[model samples]
Structures are given as structure tokens and as C-alpha cells.
Target: MAGYGRSDEEWGQLTSVGLAFLVERARLEKTTTYTELDATLRRRTGLRGFDFDQDSERAAMGHLLGLIVERNRPTTNLLISALVQYLNTNDAGPGFYALAVELGMLPRRSSATAKQAFWIGQLNALYAFYSAGRRGA
Candidate 1:
């Protein structure tokens, strides 16, 4: 939202596109890589500002994801970004844990196993919430 200098409408558009993609992934019980998600956002929103190589762009993406999580947290009670991860590692970046800590979903001094368990729980919860009665649909 900051430093990108995009209008509110543009942010809304990006959020809409990203959230829909993530929701669909949740429904399918699938995880998407950051690169794939970036491509989808670019394709859907025509926004080319999501390059993961740049630290600023990556932070912006994390901000976008944080927005999505904040917007949906009340209704879903889940961190949707758990479904998005690095392709090589099939795991989220450190920002994920930082966000969790910021959101009070995880402790600041948690162990690696605890962080992993929290992320897995969030993913499972998202899959269950989004896929409810729609797995075969």
C-alpha cells in the first residue's frame, strides 16, 4: 500500500484478484508458489510490480497478503497466506512468521516446530473452511 504509490482502487483490485486465487487454491486443497501467485496477480490485475527478487516488491507482496489475512480473519479465523509459499522449499518466508507474531497467532519466542505446526494448522483450517461441502463440486 505504501511506497508502491498505487491508488486505493488499484490496491482493491490486486487484493480481490489475489484473494480469489488463494480461496480457489484453498478449495482445491492445494498450495501455490509465490512465483505462480505473482503471475496470477499480474495476469488478473495487469500489475507488474510483484517481482520477488526485489526486497521492496517482496515486502509489498507480503503487505498485500497481510491485508488479505486481516480482511478475512474475522470470518475465516485463518491466515490465508499459509497457502502461498516458495516453490523450492514449499514453505513460507520469514515474513509469514513475523506476521503471525504480529497478529498474535504465534508467539515471538516459539520454536521452529511450533511455527511449523502453526502454519500447518492454518493451512488445514483454510482448506476445511473453503472446501466445505464443495470438494466434489
Candidate 2:
């Protein structure tokens, strides 16, 4: 994921929630329309990148909300808005790990336990998933 003011340490490492969170944050800072939201969501999501966090997720949703409040393209605005809704309600276990597995974001082989590998694998998985799939892309 692209970031504005992040430290180098935070650059290539983030959870799915963390990555989702970042998109939320960026969308907030930049103005977006329904057309913009949909287009941006599809465009950015179509690529492969980082996993956002709560702050970022909220920020992206905030951008969509701004569109609705401002009366921009309500459809696109609401479309992204629903994503925020899904994120809020859905459990992360399945969505989180599945993406990691499907995208082949994990290490090829490691002695780490399932939990360790998952966490390590999750970083790349979350980034690819959110940046390249239906969730956003």
C-alpha cells in the first residue's frame, strides 16, 4: 500500500486489518467521489500491495461518507461504504488467512509453528488480497 507519512519500519509490514486500515486512511485525506471511490477502489485494489489497519480502514470509509454527505456519486460512495460495513461485521479469521494462502504470500518452508507462519505469511497475504481482489480491487 502507498503511504504518505509512514516511517520506514512500517513500510513493508502490516496485517490485513493493518493494510485495510491504511486504505481507509488515504481515502480520507484525499477527496473522493462515488465515481472516484469506485474507480479508486477498483484501480488501487486491482494492484498488489499492503494490508491496512483500523485507522486506515476508517479513513477510507470516511472518504466515502464524505461523498454521501457532499452528495457526490452516491452509488460509488455507498459501494465503498458497504465495504466498511462488511469489514466491521465480518470475522477476520477466514478472510484474513485465506487471502494469504490463495495469493501464495507465505514463506515456502519454515520451521515456525502454524501461528508464526500465519503471522509472517499474513503480511504478504493481506497486502495482496486487499490490493488485488473484490474487497477493494
Candidate 3:
């Protein structure tokens, strides 16, 4: 995906949600260090050199989110907007599952839990938002 400029507010919002997802995943997986999470993400996505600090999960997540948002600003902003809209109109959930799936962060054939399904919807909405933005651009 191409990068697009985003406001500070948009970046903050996206970072917040992304961090939440990372934290929750860490908690669920019982990870004690940022290295674990970094390794997991790399293994799952087949990417490398994420710059995880190895100090704290929170710091690592912040750094990773910053890099991802900066690298894929348009899609990240659309993901954040879709997440916020879902939160306001529907329910609480991580908004990154679909983005994750697209980026190979999650497996495509994996059956989503209820919470994940909600996020999946947000992911689908992101595609719609991105399409609209591309047209306008």
C-alpha cells in the first residue's frame, strides 16, 4: 500500500488501537518480553528487522506501530477510521485482524472468534475507506 499523509490525531488514534491489539495479544499468549512478540510477528508475517527494543512490550509495540503507520499511512488511517466507526456504531474489538490477515499477520483460513470477527468487519470497512480515498486522491 502507498503511504499517505495523516494528521497527528489520526496517527495517535491508530497507534492507540494498534498498541491495544499488541498488548492484548501479548497477554493472551503470555509473552514476557518484547522479543517474543517481535519474533512471533516476524514468523507469522515472514518479515524481519522490526527494531523491537527487547525491553518492554509497550515500547516495542509503540515503535512497531509508528513504523507501520509511517510506512502504510493511508491504509493504517483507513483501518483506524473503520475501527472508530465500529466502536461508535457497534461494539468493542481490535480493528487490525483484517489488516493483519491482508499483511499475513493472521492466517486467512483461521476461524475467527467473535471478537476477531468484529475486527474482521473493521478490516473490510478499511478496504472501502481506502477505495474511497484513492478515488478522491
Query: lDDT: which is higher, 1 or 2?
Result: 1
Q: Kindly report the root-mean-square deviation of model 3 from the true structure over all alpha carbons.
A: 14.3
| Top lDDT model | 1
Model 1, span 1-137: residue lDDT tens: 54566677777888888888888899889999888988998888887757778887888888888887777777787788899898878577788899899888899999999999998998898888887645321
- The local distance difference test score of each candidate is 0.83, 0.36, 0.43
74-110 per-residue lDDT for model 2 (tens digits): 2122222222223233222333333334445444442
Q: Candidate 3's residue-wise lDDT over 1-137, tens digit each?
A: 11233345544544454444443432333212334545555554444434534545344444445454444445344333223222124432233444555655457666647545645565564445444234221
How close is every model to the real structure, measured as TM-score? 0.91, 0.21, 0.28
RMSD per candidate (Å) reads 2.5, 16.4, 14.3
lDDT of 1: 0.83
In TM-score terms, candidate 2 sits at 0.21
Q: Comparing 1 and 3 by lDDT, which wins?
A: 1
- Report the error of model 1 at residue 137, Å: 16
Report residue 130 deviation for candidate 3 (angstroms).
Answer: 0.8
**Candidate 3, overall lDDT?**
0.43
